[model samples]
Target: MTTDLVAAVDIGGTKIAGALVDGTGDLLHRVQLPTPAGESADRVMAALTEVLGGLTRHASWSRVAAVGIGSAGPVDARTGTVSPVNIPGWRDFPLVEGVRATTGELPVTLVGDGAAIAAGEHWRGAARGRSDVLCMVVSTGVGGGLITDGRLRPGPTGNAGHIGHISVDFNGDLCPCGGRGCVERIASGTNIARYALAAGWRPADPEGDTTAAGVAVAARDGHPLALEAFDRSARALAAGIAATATLIEIETVVIGGGVSQSGEVLFAPLRRALREYATLPFVRDLEVVPAQLGTDAGLVGAAAACWSDPGTFLAVGAAGN
Candidate 1:
């Protein structure tokens, strides 16, 4: 019998990537498209359909068994309804059924973007051999996924891993989630710039703004304000990670995305802060490292989701007699 092919799609705030993948995590027929900003859900669906059609037409796969989607937040994975705050048009949208209908009756799996990343890491990335790990994406926004005992924990409807929203400061900035002191409101790239601006690091064109990478460069070049901003963000992230480590006793924390590109600039202070905060000696040694798969993580993760059996995405390490 011929091997089954799966279609994996990862939808982010800026871009959408999809690929045809085999069970062994080999991705083929990759394609990418810009996510339509401020468009209605139907229009977004149209965009997805167009891209999927192009991919299906170009790829020479005999049979497509399933389609898996890893979408931005507030998605109900059980019902497949996506209500992401970033995607205004996606309120209560039946994403899995919608994709299924669009693809003509193929099985569709809808999962939170965080869960997808975790699944990807579990299947083939940094946490491949581990049983408990946290996969974090620190980009425009900070997102997280949890895999405990090698199983994906999506919480209720795959939205449980909103680590960015965890309150780091009691009297800090107000968040979109109606909370104060959310980690994302402070440490996300957007907030990093916001904090930098608040500290008087101004550019000629404020609207054009500085990126996390640019800030890292400026910090390395001896910009005091940028260095302070990075320190503050790192402190917040480390605190969050320490708290997670304490609560869950995680084995590893895998970080990915744009901010993580800062390399040691981001990791050093984070490690320092985590060490300072983690009172327990065991939690202090929790491995924190950059993601191995890089940009392909989302695609690889989506494919992992496609191959996973629902409610049992976790893998158990083999028992030694």
Candidate 2:
């Protein structure tokens, strides 16, 4: 008997990564493709087809049972349509069905990128064997997903994990969502750079937008402006976390993504801010840690979604069957 394998795809603004993942979450085969910029949905799908075609030719066809996709924001897992803000021309595109058309009737699963990360962590990373966990990706934006009572909440339309939209300050900066001060508007990678720019923090990468990672590096090197920038980001993130903890009381908050790679530069200040602001004693002790899977998380989580039955998560799938 052949072991069942799942093809997992992680689609981001910069690139698309795919892997053949086994039941144990081991990557058997991997492929990377540059995501076309400013292209129509058809062109982007063509790029994906090229990569998938190559991967399928190399791997055993009999063992591949499913295809799983983890895509950026505004994706509906049930419908498998993607409408990422960063990726132009992908408004409600039939991403899962498009990929499935190439897979010869194999089962295809779709999930929010942030939710996929949370599931990936629970499967093999920081949140493994943990039920109540809030996984956050503080990279290009501060996105998050929730796992509560040993169940992953995809919510209606699978858009439940838009933690970035959570408001931190009622009268603060106006968000793109037309709200006052959303967590993303203040603490996300894009907004962090925006704050740095407003504060006149110049960088050697003049043409490039000064990112959160750049600010963290500058702070590490004792740049006062960068230090101030991180301080402000930390405050906003901490306040958001505190509010989330008050509501959910999760056991841990796992932080990942590009900006989170700053290590102590981001975590230390985040913890300090969290401790200072978190009013509840229970919320203060909520462990904030780095994600273990690193870059492979999105793929792994997508695979996990496939392993889960339709409209169900891993735990429920396992028990029901």
Collision pairs in model 2: none
Q: Across residues 111-218, which tens digit of lDDT does each residue of candidate 2 receive?
A: 788878887888888988887888999987888877887656655555556778898899888988788899999888887777887888877677743777778778
Per-residue CA lDDT of model 1 for 3-63, tens digit only, reads 3677888887778888887777778788888988489998888777776876678545455
Top of the candidates by TM-score: 1
- lDDT of residue 183 for candidate 1: 86
> How many Å off is the CA of 57 in candidate 1?
2.6
Q: How far out, in Å, is residue 90 in model 2?
A: 1.1
Q: Residue 70 lDDT in model 1? A: 84
